[model samples]
Target: MAKVSVDRPVAPSAHPPPSRIGLVGFTTMFVIGTDTFLVAPLLPDLTRSFGVSTEVSGWMVSGYALGYALLALVAGPLSDRRDRRRVLLSGLLAFSAATALCGCATGFWSMVAFRFLAGAAAAFVSPQIWASIPALVPPGRIVRTMGLATAGLSTAQCAGIPLGGWLATVSWRLSFWTVGAVALVVWLVLLRMFPSVPAAPGAAGGLRATPRLYAAILGRRRLALFLLGYFVFQAGNLGSFSFVGTWLTRDFGLSTGSLSAAMVALGAGNVGGSLLTGRVAGRFGPRRALLLGLAVSVALFCALPFAPNLATALVLLSLIVGGVGFMFPVVMTLLQQEAGDARGTVASLANAVMYGGTTVGAALCGLLITGLDGFYGVAGFTVVTLLTSTAVFAASGLFRADPATA
Candidate 1:
């Protein structure tokens, strides 16, 4: 708590206690996650301020995704080569600066540029939380701690979106300023809580060894297939999710306020499910938890297309997202186990594919809806991808029990 002795780098053997580090990791992830959709409600103000069309104004959102997607691939390797605390602190510093800069933007491109910079910096920030959990916590606590960290993201979305929207009602710039200020405070907390984590085994050979380290993971067919499976999984998963808002509006005739309330409810379910996952996975093991969550997700998604009323639709949507919440941390924990020492590389790749999946799923679902009509298209596509992911994970032996980890 007393700054982790900054004059000298603290090694993992002398790392901060698991309980303390876990809280900081959770807080670290929450602060970063809170900023994720903080810009959503500001879009209208942004459009007016920039004198741009709706589509052009969307570049603000697109800019963040673009920056994150592009930088994560690079951030992973860079993270593996140094003390993760250094990477996290450095990244958070940049994130805080860029976020605050958004409130001071002079014009459209400058705002977009600042958003992009914040996002790029975030790519470096969030993944470190994921990558560091294994090194910081005992093996038995890894899955739960990961779940705790994961809950931070879903919970942040539940909390942050509404907070940002409210702040936007006051002033769009106020949202950025508030998030920036929160991030700075979180930075100070992390500076004290996080120790300088030892680099991965791959880091031993220094900069020249980075390529070989990458090749080691790439050369393995199973890991490659697992990544491919994850990519497709994200595509269907995000694709269906992205259209839920449109589906509710078109069919249920919900107003913007109604829709926001519904989304918050769904996010609440997701937060509950994520927290539940840790206990369930801890008791029954991740394999059973994963299977059960996957089955539930498939059923809920299949049933979603048939909801006859707003109540039914909301229940089905909530269930679907809840199931998704349960599955994510288990999948992530399994992936981390597989990665062992190279957690950053895998986290980065997984993160990148996740964004890629969101992109593809959104586009593909749009076409599906055009052809098939309504939520049916999105739900049907999601079901297929979910099933495919199950098969791929099975084939990759991702569900196997690890002797070293619970």
Candidate 2:
């Protein structure tokens, strides 16, 4: 029932290697993620440059995120109607332009406008990769290829955060300029190497049709359940993750340098796991592998509070992030499969929920971190949420391939 890609897609070859599409996917995710992390390190400089209170400066972060999250709903249905290749290129061009414009901003609101545009443009780019992958790759390779894309974000957390800080030392504008330049290079490569992918056979995409399309998609009973499960999955994962730095500083008395080093170690584990977890998919299938990873995360969280030393805590954190890496591709693949031809719609929804989960998680954990005696509140809350999400997935009955048989 799925439409074959023909007009233009990420790759055009009859039997293109997964790595080729994955390469562009990785680069796209990395560029967007780096931009996301870049603003945090540059915040102080941004405040001084814009002559705003620290609180007002936080709008730069929220403004970018608002564009990214809100526009995804619109971009999704639009990508579903056209050649994703063109859509991706246009998004890249717009994203690149807006990123560069951030360097030229004369005042606070102009900078926010540029960042919002950059984020909105970015919303269009990633959905194309996620949507086109199934049509572009061998069936067996879907989850594996998604893992390669997932690696991009972990890599950004590891490398780009510090790079942004270092660039900020010279000038915050340099950070945007650097990422924008890299994005331009990526756009060129994708333009040359990518091929055409057409819309789903029967989809009628128009601004007017957007509401009907979403109404139909959301009307599906199983998919709605699946999306709910994914939301909770992210809520627990991100909630626990958001607190790691605070936990380290409080429990270990680690300074900024030591905390960064510890975070890098955990991030490295995430990157490694993201790159390698495809093998787990090959062996156990995506659903089983993901459940296995979640179980491991639950165990890790359970043990983390009891860790007696910095080394022990770091080891546990690394494994936990690695488990997250192991889980990501599988969950994404399942969500895409549930999407059927609505890959773009589902991908955008996924991103939206991911941000929502992080926001809600961080907010809730703020209270838990302060309320319940050391890190136990965070640990206990995370464990309960993980288990609850796992239960949701189990009850949804979506994993029909069954880990039992695999």
Candidate 3:
């Protein structure tokens, strides 16, 4: 049996101490999630504040996604060739500023502009986290650490939105301010705790391979269908949360408290799902776990529209969010293994696809809800997208461990 080598060159530590790195990653994810979902509970208030329709108010959510999607393509390569810590810190600082700016903006359009900038800035951190993880931990421990990191995000999603909603009730502007404050803390922690790791010397040359890389990523027969399917799958999971708070307000006359509670449920589900995936993926194989997640998510999301009451809605939402949590961690694990030594570059590219899906899901849902008459249309669209994504993932045979690893 070929044993794994203990003498392999150690990957440079971009994150400082294990505990500090985990703390920074956790805080970063917490604030980012808060910023991203903060607008959900406040969408109605935004609509009222700016005197815009639900569609226009949605810019608060969708606009950020647009920024994230556009910048993702470049963020990865830039992280590979530069100091990832600096890149992450700069992004967090910018996001912090943008979130604070969101508070001071008097009008809706101004808020949208700031949200977009914040989104673009926030995009930098996620890919950096992904790139840094393999470097920070031993290979055998990578999956578990990633799980913990994912849990941080899940906790943020579960707790942040409701807290944001409650804050918004005090002052919608306060929600943004809160996000900024959290981001500032995260930036400080990262600066103080995370070590500086320089980019690979010839990493710039990797940028020259951009076209080939793009083609390789997009055109690979084994990966193409999976990527496409995953894109749609993410769209479904994301799109529901993008507008669900608004639906609750419009459909069931829910209060801020009730809406916040529902958001909490969603976040809890995310955490639960991620934890479950971490335990199960290795046992079942990443592909099987992913397929299972997508299948369950589709069913849960489809059932959301017909939920009879707030209780039912929250229960269904838990299932949907948990499914998302379970699915993505597995996908990320698969992606890392697939990328091999060029993990940073590969991570960046994968991030680009993920954010692209986010942009599409948010925008597409916004368009559908705004263009159509009701929330049902939006829900139906989410179902279709998820189903399509599931089918796509199922058709592709990428779930098996790469033969190279074998």
TM-score of each candidate structure, all chains considered together: 0.83, 0.81, 0.90
For candidate 3, what is the TM-score? Answer: 0.90
Q: For candidate 2, lDDT tens digit of each residue in 239-316?
A: 556556666766677654455566577778888778767688778787878788888889999998899888988888
235-296: candidate 1 lDDT, tens digit per residue? 88866665565567667776545555776878788887887886888787887688778778
Q: Cα RMSD (Å) per model?
A: 5.2, 4.3, 4.2
Q: Which residue pairs collide, candidate 1? A: none
Estimate, for each residue in 144-235, the C-alpha lDDT of model 3 and write its tens digit: 66777777788888888788888877888888888898888878878887766666544444456555555655565656676677678667
TM-score winner between candidates 2 and 3: 3
In model 3, the Cα lDDT at residue 353 comes to: 64
List where candidate 1 sits over 4 angstroms from the true fold: 1-15, 38-62, 100-115, 171-173, 200-208, 250-256, 282-284, 366-373, 399-406
lDDT of candidate model 3 versus the reference: 0.73
Clashes of 1: 0
What is the C-alpha local distance difference test score of each model? 0.75, 0.75, 0.73
Predicted structure 3: clash tally: 3
**Candidate order, TM-score descending:** 3, 1, 2
